[model samples]
Target: MWNKIEMKRWHRLFYDQLVRRWKQNIVFAAATIFFLQFLIVKLHPSEVQEFNEAQCADIYPKLKQGLISVNEGMRTLVGHELKLIGEKEFDVTGYTVKRPLLNCLDQEDELLHRTIKEKYFVKGNVSGRGFSKPYEELKHPYQTQDLLELVFKELRNGFYVEAGAWDSEQMSVSLLFEVGFNWTGILIEANPWDHQLGLLRNRNALYLNTCLGLTVRPQFSDFVFTPAVEVKEGQWMASMGGLSETLLNPDSIKLQCFPFYSILMAAGNPTVNLLILDIEGAEFAVLKTIPWNKVDIQVMTIETDLIGKAGISGGSQEEAREFIISKGYTLFKHRNNINPVTGLENNDLFIRNDIVKKWNIKFPEPLN
Candidate 1:
């Protein structure tokens, strides 16, 4: 009996040790998996691209191939060449070339180069044109020239505002400063990560980490942020309607109240010479909410897409036009013309009439 009892006690001890080891192993495995996932997310292309790939899978084959080709061409040519010019201090006097190599590279490159140059260079934003997104094969023409001209034409040195600034490596505000737009504006962003990045990129620009709604002051509400920070009720949320509840996981979202009007008022109420709005689908709501008549805004450029999955539409663009027109602003230029049948072109511009009359800017013949 004593021997049997001792044997049972030994077995119990063994079982406990085995359970402890199993639990430790399971914990270690879980930690390892979490670490790997973190590394992948941090090192991967971008959250936007990932989301695009996952959600836009069906359109990926058509859009992705073209986007990649354009991206490679642009990456090889534009930003790199500009950087080289800066490093070497080389003069870009009449350095224009419609290279066939751009077409021969790939369908993506061909589409990208054509769209980027036409939209960005012809309209004037940057000095050169290139693909804004390479991997996705989406050709985004940087209007370096238009941007430079605007910077030089309007602001020698003063406040500038960039509304709807979001988190995308391609839409860096630093590029504005690099091309010499005196960083004087309120950088408004809704997403936490993008807002944080904007703050990092533009040190001189005052960063407002909230969405601009129709309200005169920032109001405390809940916002739907992805992966990093879920819904918290304490953060300030924009008052725009028609937001996707599923994407935001509305249940877990949090809201925070903030003073929107106070921040703008504090930003010196400087005459806004140039305004760029690319706030996804919320552009119309935000614009409608603002007292544009009271503000001395000079030139406004916006992105208009016929079938934006994010709910941007022609109606929104028209509404924006009407709003600007009501404020005695005229349409200066329209760029990145897209065929509703084919979702190809990325960046487009719409300038105010007052800017056109003042600058004597000529519009490029509409591309068929």
Candidate 2:
């Protein structure tokens, strides 16, 4: 109804207004999104971990409340406490009770190359195919540790891979076997001081001063190992190591990390006679990362209570049990031993089906 110029002017005005409003709306929306993102990041900063040795010291302070970093990550270094009174050379010829710790620097790699058959068969008291005697009950906190020792007592030079092997001998499931039976293997500890103590105690076994992990991804950055002030003298804060950084105090040390397979390779991929895994709460991750095809584990004693309790998998103990069974192992015993400190029932022992079949290893009458 209007003139041509008037119509054109009206159209232009309408189009301009529409574009301006649209632009303003878009800007508002974008600003809102940006503000929300900023608030989220600031309020709940996501954690990131890096595993660079060079960056280990530098990244500790920058780690948020919950963050970790790991890079590609062993050996027994003797502690100063156990002063070597006798000769430094480790010799188990007579099974002396008062033997001092020996430096395992040179002997670690050599032991890794030795298989279970070679060590136990050649050097051990393998009079029969396996132990024919009834399993004995020892003075151990959990009867399972002694039971495990008795199962393979006939095999000398037997090998064990103990994750989270704290103090080597103190409450160690494999300590009796190593000292009495002449077995040797690798002991992995996350705490630097404990690792040193492990080295001093376990001269026969190779000790690794690192944490075993599932993925190469770093877990927490700027993690300091700080235990609660109320922790008792003899008790160890399990969470102070590789389990959770949140509980660590300011004095905690950064842990060197590695994958399970990587650790096996470093240990020359020996055939594992026994695998004792108690890596705080990261047992699931370590179990998941194990290269089943590469090694033959005859017996495994693992802490199962923390399986899906934490970490990314959110997996449960039943799921963990099922997973282990799926990997050629049978749940032999659910010990359900309550940890003296935490009072949590966590110990579960599994035996390789093939080993049980081959050796005809029958379940002994329950001692408990």
Candidate 3:
């Protein structure tokens, strides 16, 4: 009912107030977004370095003690997530997934994924075809065995000799090569309990219930056996197959021993494709006894940490490497990656230069 001039003025005033309010709201929204971005940048942490298993020795005890429950929990949770996502077989260990996952995972999944990303190198490729599990998802305590499998992905048949082959399948480096690659060889274990278990588990390989040394005997004494009488609940016992004579006590257990040369003769002196020697602390003595000229061993994995113990010398890493080099073998990989809590010794892998040339094989650098 107002006159035209009056109505026009009123409308302009109302429109002007609305425009001012809109501009104020825009400024407030921009300030809010800026504040949020600043908070995110300030609170975000730096990316964690890829965890080297060799460096994990210190953290292993905490994981075992449940002090760092998140690691175990993360493993189980990741395994569960894989199954839910229709992945029947996948490795949840510290070896999988090398890249960051920004928005591909949910909130909780993203957090756990980031935790793993911060610790391990993403080495897995899920889409590759004709590859039967780039690596074994389980069973191997470490990736050394699996990495060996990766190294020999070409060969169809070969021979292996596994010393200190605990329970044959449990942490047995030769098991995968034998089962997966159709290779055959010998398994040597001195522990009665472990030997019996190996017999039951490793049906494909020839099981030898004897120890390796420079001398063969129907029986040997003063070897330190584990599960000691003084072990407490939740406590563990330590036993190396052979230790320095100085370290052996009067109460040490007795076990049968044999010469490596005799074992080779019994096997018809076959060309050994791989030789895994892990006789605890006495590895070097047994290693020196091997007449490298007489045997044609292409590749060998030695647990050299045995030489690092007190009262154990002459079998030092330097001496061992020099001896193997003298025998025309080149160091392929030396795995010293150990967790401090476990005190696990490092292992060395060597390949004969002649055999490498013959087979046209390439060697990978030490993983540790």
Candidate 4:
């Protein structure tokens, strides 16, 4: 029995050595073949194609034909149905169009403040309660007028927080300044290139070049930029993803951990009236971590889409609506109806219940 055990041990050692040697030989053979192919390609470029033709020509045509037939069949089955749907398409001319106006009984100043108060907390056609102004009309004569309108209707002057403030070109910043909202807000952005632009545009706003997370634990974070295709001149607003999912060289991307509460405290712990979250899919993580009771944020606007490349999933439109209701907010308006396929409304708005109740406003039950 001892002799048999010793033989078994010897056999194991011999097999291990054989595997090691085989692996080395295989690697050596592969490297040699690669070097030879490289040399051949360098010396006779035309011969590379000739060799491929000789090796794969017999099966290449059949494979190509099979793939083409499958693609054609799929196109006929699915594409034809989509074409027949005939969704009406329209173009978004610009941000400003015919909007609703507030029908309140008071003097201009009183009406302005009343309008601001109603829209500030409630969600509905708050835009129409005031005036029609384009995003570019930041410095217009009716700028203050429009600002007062939003302030009275949708924004809480001293108690609001905005995340992912990309640049000063955004409508939110314009209204914030124009209305003279007593804002103590922190603008968090990860991109250095865009951060500089944001500084120039939002000179008055506090800027931080870091991503927000659930904890303040010291750790690395990754940010990846994906360019926007349909929109012109706003590539910086493209959806952000983690480096592992986006970057070709994951090692090069650096990450930093930050606590969500730290950001809120940094913003001076103002009564958070409005929380505009446009952190791409990062919204899911940030929202999940928020101390909702401490931060009485009344209104929140978030972007929802099915084609998100960020690893987030499972929040359908219905789910999002229910989630907002659970948090005491209601869907108000769907904005910018430039549907690419049918060109109708796309953007959405949600308002807190307190605002709706205070203003005595009512909206139909949201379509499931």
Candidate 5:
């Protein structure tokens, strides 16, 4: 039989094998962002994104990647922790980490508190009823931000994990929690981290440029992203990002994928306050990777509409929904339109039944 010390040693070895070490400063990320911004105006950007999108502000502009060490363990494998698992089948040309090239950790607890007190006013406690915050100003497309506020109601100092965190600021669901409430989170994006290094360098979370999948073993998924539309030298358009099961674009990129549990395990699997999933149509597949019994999440917002529609496996979102609900979640809020917080369609909001009981959340039934 294995002893306790042996078990711990094995765990450390596993953590080391799963992650890589890197060094980069925020100065380079800032410079890159400045250059990318200049190029955005000079280049012909994709028509998909809106015109004049605001940039994502950093919390600690001077913090270094070395400061936020990848303290190998289950919970320590996020933010500054970005690496390929199993095998390195794909090219990591730009995957190199150096000053938020692909992985970033922005921590600003003290500054955030000062900003909240100086900039905004709160009339009541976060957990209390009739919470009002006219001074609270944060937003996301599709009413998602509103949903989080409505559900969590000013909850502070929580944890969030998001898949498909692109652009960092424009439509991020976890930004509000991070900047306003001092919450920590994990951002996973399949696009090159360098593309948005400028916008992502200051988030109070670990930002990654990888996709999520259901496979337990190491795998790869084809993604569609125009790193930038450079019309001429030094002139570039803003990046266009997306992921898919089918390789529709000839210029598609293949990104290495890791199971959801691998990420949580690396993070110490701390009780997740909010978990947002906007991984294009692979929601079902990615969610399948989680061992619900082992993970604890207070609330979840997932985008379900893609996958299983006409795939070879003939999977269905309904099956996914059933699988999740079977675990311990209650289908409380469901919407067909866009979520203001997540900026995704065909959304569903679920609260863990235990959370509902513990927090006394009274919600309506799921919509058809």
Candidate 6:
């Protein structure tokens, strides 16, 4: 199976210090196809004859008949050509034929935890026993573990979309839902942390190593990630970068950028149960991009502390709160506590109005 393949080559590229210093955004196509033929368990590309101008139209029918095998690894790539999302439709004649060459030079991406249960994931609260999967194992900075369980009555096999998902394991608000509840979803993280302790490789979620922006389309942006730690003696890992409206230095690390709505569409627009944002104050802008009417997100948790911080989103928590409330979400839960250990701000959980109406969740009262 594709999931069984060991993605050592792919992980190395993502984690390599040199690539971190040089190329941050890996081209989409080559990332999946570079070693696919060699590693796809005896599945090789079905070669087709070279196409001249005369044979241009012939590529269409051959592609229709599965004469070529570029069908694999075309996810989240080529907006104009593949039409994964946007006004354009899949242009078999224009784009399908170039898969062979593009695959050779595509950037590196490896889908981890596919065809397997999430690591350390349990079927239920099987904690405290021998070889048991404990509850509340993966702790979020904002106590989302308790928040989620209380809200859902310990619901399992749910779905989530976690932006700023750091390293799948540490302080990830979404991993506990996956590992403890057997839920699977998306994990979006970007650079600096990706270089330091970022870019998930073990979690069962679909990993997108990109930054979220308030955009109508998928694009690249300069990710200004300042490492909160030192790499060596008298040397810091702080590289100059900028956020959406950041007043930072000229030098910034460029990473793959996409709007929140576009990313949901790229991920097949699944109904997101819990949308958690902890991307260092980029939450407001990213949240604005989600097409609230089309996408059904039941609940959201945002780091509200960074709202008024200069060089961040340049917006206040009131603005963020107003924007969210306007989107038909009611502030479902909030606790007053800036996390001491991780220094994480308190996350305000907002439940969609429709969901609140459907579930009839009353604050501080258990649902029967």
What is candidate 3's local distance difference test score? 0.51
Q: What is the per-residue lDDT of model 2 for residues 100-215, given as tens digits with 9 covering 90 to 100?
A: 11111111223222321232111222232121122242233353344554466467778888887765654467766765677888777765556644454424666665566555
State the lDDT of candidate 5 residue by residue for 33-100, as single tens digits: 56545433322223212112121123124323333322211110111212232233222224312122
lDDT of 1 by residue, 138-191 (tens): 212244345555433445565556655553234443334433544455666554
lDDT of each: 0.40, 0.50, 0.51, 0.40, 0.50, 0.49
Clash counts for the predictions, in order: 44, 21, 8, 24, 19, 4
Model 6: worst 10 consecutive residues (lDDT sum): 106-115
Question: Which RMSD does model 6 reach against the true structure?
Answer: 14.7
Give the Cα error of residue 39 in candidate 4, in Å: 33
Off by over 4 Å in 6: 1-138, 192-201, 227-244, 339-345, 364-368
Error of 5 at 102 (Å): 18
Q: Highest lDDT: which candidate?
A: 3
Q: Kindly give the stretch of ten consecutive residues in candidate 4 with the minimal lDDT sum.
A: 75-84
Point out the worst 10-residue segment of candidate 5 by lDDT: 72-81
Candidate 1, residue 99: CA error in Å?
56
Q: Write the per-residue lDDT of candidate 6 for residues 100-184, one digit (tens) a residue.
A: 2112211211111111123211122223222112333423554464456556668788888877665455456766677668888
Model 1, 153: alpha-carbon shift in Å? Answer: 5.2
lDDT of 3 at 172: 66
Rate residue 160 of model 1 by lDDT.
55
